[model samples]
Target: MRKADLLDELRAEIGAMSDKYSSELEKLYQFVCNSLFDNMADYQWVSIYLVEDFSFCLKFERGQTELPPVIPFGEGFMSLAAARGSVVRERIWNRTEVYVPFYHGHHLVGVLVVTGTAGGNIDDEDISLFCELASLFESKVKKCNS
Candidate 1:
């Protein structure tokens, strides 16, 4: 699917799915993960990790391979994403991975990770779109905590 169309459809699905989830925030996460997995083939997995005291914990995940349930704050490349305070994309041997940091104002709230690329490499436009999605998650995170 085209980027704009995919985002629009995902947003629409999230909007329509509010009743299915506990909140709009959860609907966003659920829809995005399922939608992306359905539409984007190259992406092998989608996962969201959020801060829990001094570490990041897995809030949601789907697709191949297994992810650690917890990662200490300021540790690993996930910390790099937190440190960057934005989207971070890097090639990991055979596959490229994208990491989107989620924030609640100045606080590091969470991160979204997608493994693999659209093709051989990820597009800058795609990263921009992912950041837009991350912004949506950020707002939801803020609202949930408030």
Candidate 2:
């Protein structure tokens, strides 16, 4: 499916979903993971990390391999994303990866990381989609927290 179509479908699905804050956020995470994993064959891993005090805690993940439970606020690729409060894309051990930061109000929430599979590479479209997802998550989180 094209990026535009995928985003439109996601928006529609998210609108139809109704639940409590945490539950809805978890569902959103799962939806994002499954949707990206299924729609973008090149991507083999997708995760949502929640910020806790000064650390990035793994909230949800779906991929070919597992991820660590926690990472400091300023460490690794995820840290780079949080540090800049934007998207960071780089090649790590041959696979292309993109990390995006999520924010609620003026506070940093966490990060979203996506990695390519095998020799797969991430493109501009993937970055845009990830950014959009991050924005959506941030908006929902802010509303929930309020």
Candidate 3:
């Protein structure tokens, strides 16, 4: 499926499931990770890293391999995006990086990192959609926690 179509389906699913259960945030997190891998075939790594204390730690991941030890709040792509409150995309010969900020109101909560081979380089449209999904995920997490 095309990326737009994939995102549309995800938006629909998230909208439908957002308020249905007490564990909806966890379900949303799982859905985003699974949907991205299942629909975006180019992605080799997908994970959600939530802010804990002063660091961003991997809370959920999927695809070919596991992520590294930890992704701190102000390190690498996660830091760049989180600090700027925007999406960051990079294309390296063997690796591609995409980071989308997760926010709760005006506060940065975490980040979603999707990495893969160079062929998986995400474009502006993909980043925009990912940001939307990340917003929903952040909102649900905050709501559930509060």
Report, for every candidate in turn, its global Cα lDDT versus the true structure: 0.75, 0.78, 0.75
Order by TM-score, highest first = 2, 3, 1
Question: Cα lDDT for residue 39, model 2?
Answer: 71
Q: What stretches of model 2 exceed 4 Å from their correct place?
A: 1-23
Best by the lDDT measure: 2
Q: List model 3 lDDT by residue over 26-137, tens digit each.
A: 6667667877777777788788888888888888778754456576655677889988888888776677788888888777777888887556556676777787878777
Off by over 4 Å in 3: 21-23, 65-67
- Cα TM-score per model: 0.81, 0.84, 0.82
Q: Decide which is better by lDDT, 2 or 3.
A: 2
Task: Give the CA lDDT, 0 to 100, for residue 107 in model 1.
Answer: 89
- Model 2 pairs in collision: none
| Residue-wise C-alpha lDDT for candidate 2, range 20-85, written one tens digit per residue | 334467787877787777777788888888889798898888786555879877678888777778
Question: Model 3, 76: alpha-carbon shift in Å?
Answer: 0.9
Instruction: Estimate, for each residue in 83-131, the C-alpha lDDT of model 1 and write its tens digit.
Output: 9787788877778788899888998878888887435445675677678
**Residue 143, model 3, lDDT:** 79
The parts of candidate 1 lying over 4 Å away from their true place are 1-8, 11-24, 117-120
